[model samples]
Target: MSRIGKRPVDLPSGVSATVSGQMVEVKGPKGTRSFTATDDVTLAMEDNAITVTPRGKSKKALQQWGMSRTMVANLVQGVTEGFKKELEITGVGYRAQMQGNTLKLALGYSHDVDFQVPSGVTVTCPKQTEIVIEGSDQQLVGQVAANIREWRAPEPYKGKGIKYKGEFIFRKEGKKK
Candidate 1:
């Protein structure tokens, strides 16, 4: 039995969840998101909470049970509070700015990097060194942030690059003289 799968996901006020077969859809103030779980796990909606259970006593079924429950919970949270990621540029000349729907980045590169923001996800540069990513889909928001960070990852020595706001970079000792 899965501990996490045993707990039910409560639907807050102004949020509604519908379960049809293996698919569960959640609609909230932010947006509506749906997920289709594997056949090993079953989905049920009771009152204002959603629950998940495995079909049989198998390893795969048990594994999916917890995962399915988490996914459903994420859906509910996504539609309500949504997801956000913040990135901070750390370098002398590194900064970020927005031009219409494109994100212009200056990361000490030869040319300014231009990142096109996707439809569902919104990218904002509140400050020259800060980048804010927000969206209802958790996966999309994270992927967009990762793509932007890939342009210039923080280095261990100088720690100069684009990285998450709370991320830490371990420094290495310089070569002996």
Candidate 2:
């Protein structure tokens, strides 16, 4: 039995859920999101809660049970509270600023990097060294942050680059004299 799957996801006061076949749709204040589960698992909505159960006693069924449950939970959270990811820029003259729908980044490059902001997600730069990404979809928010960080990943030697908030870079020794 799957521990997480056994626990039903509770619907908060302003949130509602509907189950049709193998698909589950959740609507909340933030937005509406849906998930389609595999045939190995079943989805049901009852008493303002959603539950997932495996169709049979098999390894794949059990695996899908837990994953399906988590996916449903994420849908609920996404519609209700949404998701957010923060990035920090480190290095001299490296900064970030929002210009309309574009995120202008200065990561020590000769030319500024312009990142186009996608729909359904909002990117903000509270400070020159800070970037905050917010959106109803968790996956999109994370992907956007990753794409930005890819431009200038933090290096171990000087640690000069863009990185997630609270992330630590393992320092390496420099060349010996």
Candidate 3:
């Protein structure tokens, strides 16, 4: 009954997958990633593809059925092409720079904020006001970008702060003089 769970995940060229017990591991050009599914669902592999099916007619089994399939698909995409997130600094005196594995941010504060880059993710500042985060894991890439943006989130007035590229800031009117 789950539409998403019915579709099998296809393996592209140069990508490989192995399912052992309840764990599924995918290897590709970007990297190798794995996921362990719960007993509510069953996983099968054939012809460079993977499929998921519910173990019983219960609600939990159906829920896990679709989630497990999507997780497998994400693992395939993550290992093959990876993920990226871009952040833009839009305030005066707000900027960022990468020093080796560390990122230094200036957000109009008295002191600069130094962010240490963690393993499995790469953060780069192409320009003074631009920050780019890339990694094989989608969740890690998004979390790192969010952490950087949280340091100086965009405000309503004048929209001065850091924000995701193309993100809209709901502007509010200033008080009357």
Q: After superposition, how far is residue 72 of candidate 1 from its true place, in Å?
A: 0.5
Q: CA shift at 48, candidate 1, in angstroms?
A: 0.9
lDDT of 3 at 84: 90
lDDT (tens digit, per residue) of candidate 1 on 1-177: 789999999999999888999999899999889999999998998878999999999999999999999999999899899999999999998999999999999988899999999998999999999999999999999999999999999999889999998998999987998
lDDT-sorted candidate list, best first:
2, 1, 3
TM values, all candidates: 0.98, 0.98, 0.97
Candidates in descending TM-score order: 2, 1, 3
Evaluated against the true structure, the overall lDDT of model 2 is 0.95
List, residue by residue over 48-157, the lDDT tens digit for candidate 2: 89989999999999999999999999998999888999999999999999999999999988999999999989999999999999998989999999999999999999
* Best of the candidates, lDDT: 2
Question: lDDT per model, in order?
Answer: 0.94, 0.95, 0.93
- lDDT (C-alpha) at residue 168 in model 1: 89
Model 3 residue runs over 4 Å out of place are none
Model 1: pairs clashing at backbone N, Cα or C within 3 Å? none
Root mean square deviation (Cα) for candidate 2: 0.7
Report the lDDT tens digits of candidate 3 across residue range 1-177. Answer: 999999999999999999998999999998899999999999999887999999989999999999999999999999988889999999778889999999999998899999999999999889999999999898899999999989988999999999999999999999999
